[model samples]
Target: MTTSKITAEDVAAGVAELVPDAAPVEVVRPLRQGRSHASWVLESSRGWLVGKVLLGPAGTAGLERLAEHRRLWQHGIAVPPVLAFTESCASVADRPLTVFEYVPGVDAEEALPALEPAVVLEVMRATGTALAALHQVPVEGFDDAASGLGTISATWNTVVTSRVEALRDAYRFVDDIPAALVKTGLDLLDSLAEEVSPVARPAVAHLDVYLPNILLDDEGRFRVLLDLEHVRWVDPAMDFVKPAMWMFPDQQSWAEAFADGYRAAGPWPACWSERMAVATGLELLTGVKYWTQVADHAMREDYLRRLRAWVRSDGADHVWSAISSAT
Candidate 1:
């Protein structure tokens, strides 16, 4: 079933329908602007809350994210308590919408000023620990529904090629992007397809772990993690790149903190760090696709800065070289 377009009033109605007794007093956009879904701040007599209305039809992907959110919360990870989920095809807005207990906090993007080297290390470690914990979650009879090891191996090619075509379409109208970079990036993605996929061991992971998705409370502690839209049972290595990209920004020092954190939390297979180079390269190639295709002008510019930083990073060349060598 396809999710219908959502409006502010539709969101209000959904909230009222789900929690029939509660009255929504006001609605405001809490997030600056995101491409995935519309996020908002909802105020009610009971308390403040945030709501996310999926952009397109509610599909298995959305359901997966919700399920993962619930699962992680039950596992003691910091995340907003899910208050209500409204799903019905007959509703004015057909897409499923969820309202969450508004965890009072600031996104790491906004809180970056308060982040110092020490705090960055701590947060990086915490993120590594949290990711390790997430990867340990079990799937019951539904294991067949999740992608298999072969599927994971194929995703690198499928997602990259599809996104590259989108990039070509997007840039077909714009002239400023360098053709050489496009070709080189595409070649890199093509080369990545031949590298060995990680061992078939599967675990749950929040594949989308951008800094904006990580929140910190007023007390300077991690309050909650948001946006599990990319949740899936995949290789544990799938979760590492985004955190590294965010904390290290190409500086490999952050990897040490992450390693320390991951090890401190529990036993990670000894090969985890060994796989970082290839895993991170795939993640970077994905970023290239996103920046060249789907991202808005401002977002594209921001990503370019990060990309250049990565390219100039000390060990980044070594990472990319390893991936190339493997191919």
Candidate 2:
């Protein structure tokens, strides 16, 4: 909801300072503003590019995210390479600014709904394969910036528990969350947390993997991945959480196809079902809390509806279950 204070002049100055060679900025058109950052499509003498200005508290984490993007690119993930980054660009809204190579494509969120079912299946399968490659990149500690338990944790258990505890703590003050739902959520978290064993080894996970983060071309083929800011080292199953929750719950065949593609590339661990269930439950709880905090009643109500359904089913009505049944 925070509007960007960045102006065309600011963007031009940023381009001149950070990417002097790409100067003589011809166009600076604002793109959709995200929750934590404001972005613009920039056309310059060099070529087209995307510039992002970190907003609010997200400014401090720019360097760390830049490094993560570089790591993913080095490992062959289709993330756009960072061209230039600055921690403090006083002329550019006095916030951290990063410019990246502009990838030409539409986000799958906008493209998927219009595609033929068969093509949609192929896209989902390709997405599954792409995620497999992403998770193969080995990583050490878990870094969840939003956890508020610190930037990095030694174990995935710590991160997961911290998130559950945070939700439980919020239950006291968030009057919007139903008491019965909260109780069920807490109990489910405790039970599911126990069911999910520790991951053998951490791999890179795009913690936010919903349709909006996936890019596709004119022909509906996967082009590039977007939004590497939330990438972390965690259970590979965690990568499936968002898509499982938001992307494929109603699309059972898509889930099965994704599972097929994933199986072709790597081992589909037996624990995947439990892991996805618990992670999705926790994510729903977080979504309820977030929407309530932002006072978005419509979204809060939607999240509550989904959470209630999840609770009614005892967390079994999830994409993983759908995929398991079909497989």
Candidate 3:
């Protein structure tokens, strides 16, 4: 679908017209900082706020994001509030846009490394608890139709049997990977249908739970989890694996501490290790595919680097093994 390019000026004007009491301050562009959507920093007399506009007039997903923001907020998750959203195409560019009140805090990724290990572990524990709370909220209106996972899974299954062979034939790197490794990876993918079945839950997940989406207060508290665009009702495991995205580099101690803190908030699922393994493997594959699809010079390099790392790393294998053991 074609995305409507709505300018900041258009967003400012729309917000002013809609919320008369809201004094317009300034609209700052959030360029290249985010993926899948364009966002801006807006300052009003009310305070600093963040506003986002879908890339094109195609706003099918934007509406869902707006609703998710409201839902999470109502459920006591700290997220930017939606000041206004419209599909009326009132912008000078006639593009669909949604504006939100921006919350102030640094993303967790930027801040996590500077903190002491103990502090980082605590924050991660808080993050796990927060996610548990989010999952507890009963979501309505969003069904499986609300996800990209089904289509993603179908596409992956079809390609798993052939894409590896095709890529090997097309690229020199293909030969760099051992045939045994390829067969093992392919076996995991082929059995994805059965192995991934047990952990599936129809609960609302934060979807993308990387450090960037988490925000921290000055005291190192988990202030707010942001970015609900990818939020959906899916496996709870999807939200649980986020701390590993950044905290994994810290040490095993952190993971264990986080696990303790998470269990303090709620019960861990039976066979949790296996569930995380499958989710982590899928996460790696998703990251690799994202780079491949971007079709840009930098993206290609990034993709190849990650693909290389996945080939060498045993993390994905650990995930697969955990799942296999569970069955």
Candidate 4:
């Protein structure tokens, strides 16, 4: 499908600027479901390339994402190395674009749900192994910013607290969410965050580490973890909980497979189960406000329903029990 606001000509021009004698752009197929960038797959005389276009008010992590991918690659993680990148795209409203050699596969999200339950667990087990490998890259702070005089929180605890406070401060306008429910969830996360603080330190984490970003080959093997922009230096438990809550919520097999994968890769931090419970609560509490702001008004009922059941049902303890067995 043709991508809107971008065209074959746009891609050709973008490529020509970098490689004057490069093959003419032949195929340009749009890639959708992206929340941030307008992206495409371009086939040119040169070869196949995946192109990402960023055209908006400048955000912080664009360049850092590319850098972090290389960092992960250097640390023994398999990631697609950027072939060509440019932050200047004056031809299309000052959009910035990066071209990478494409890594092909069906999205794990689309692939896993169709398979048998045991097969799904195996794929996620592999995904968890990959995640643990990436998490082995140590980070110094809560964000992608280089740890510096003013760029980092004094303690990991401060980072966690500051995040909740920031959410509490800014998400006040999300009236669609029940205030009592939000408060209860946040309070749970706050307590959990504190309980885990005694052992917190910076570890590489992908905040949105879930099946959607994972690419799976035809044989049910893990291909690659696609997006790297939300990569952070936080508790590895954050990475653990992210998948549990999003990809296969309350699915014991999913949790079991993931924990086994983590163990398969190597030993992880101690007390991971408890830390993950805290992380789950944090993600659940903040996700209401976060997703509410990001999603359309039509999604209100869905988010509310899922969140309400979880918050009202002793969600954290139940979640911990379901997943902790895997450890």
lDDT of 1 by residue, 52-131 (tens): 77666556556656766787788777667887665442333566677787777888778867777678666656766777
List the global CA lDDT of all models. Answer: 0.59, 0.74, 0.58, 0.67
lDDT of candidate 2 over 1-327, digit per residue (tens): 123556866876787688989887655577667777777788887799888887754444557667777888888877787888888777675677888888888889889879999998888888888888887776666666253213767766666677777778877888756888877876886677666746534667777877888889999998767887776666666677778768876788888888787777777755666777776677788889889999999888887887887788888765466665333
Which scores higher on TM-score, 1 or 4? Answer: 4
Q: Considering summed lDDT, which 10 consecutive residues are worst modelled in model 1?
A: 141-150
Superposition TM-score, candidate 1 onto the true structure:
0.69
Number of the top candidate by TM-score? 2
Q: State each model's C-alpha RMSD to the native.
A: 6.2, 2.9, 6.2, 3.8
Q: What order do you get sorting by lDDT, best first?
A: 2, 4, 1, 3
* lDDT at residue 244 of model 4 (Cα atoms): 59
TM-score for each predicted model, relative to the true structure? 0.69, 0.87, 0.71, 0.83
Candidate 4: stretches off by over 4 Å: 1-4, 15-25, 44-46, 113-121, 144-150, 295-315, 318-320
Q: What lDDT tens digits, residue by residue, belong to model 4 across residues 67-111?
A: 667678778785666766666665445567666677777888788
Local distance difference test, candidate 4: 0.67
User: Model 1 scores what on Cα lDDT?
Assistant: 0.59
Better of 2 and 4 by lDDT: 2
Clashing residue pair totals per candidate (backbone < 3 A): 1, 0, 6, 0
Candidate 2 CA-lDDT value: 0.74
- lDDT pick, better of 2 and 3: 2
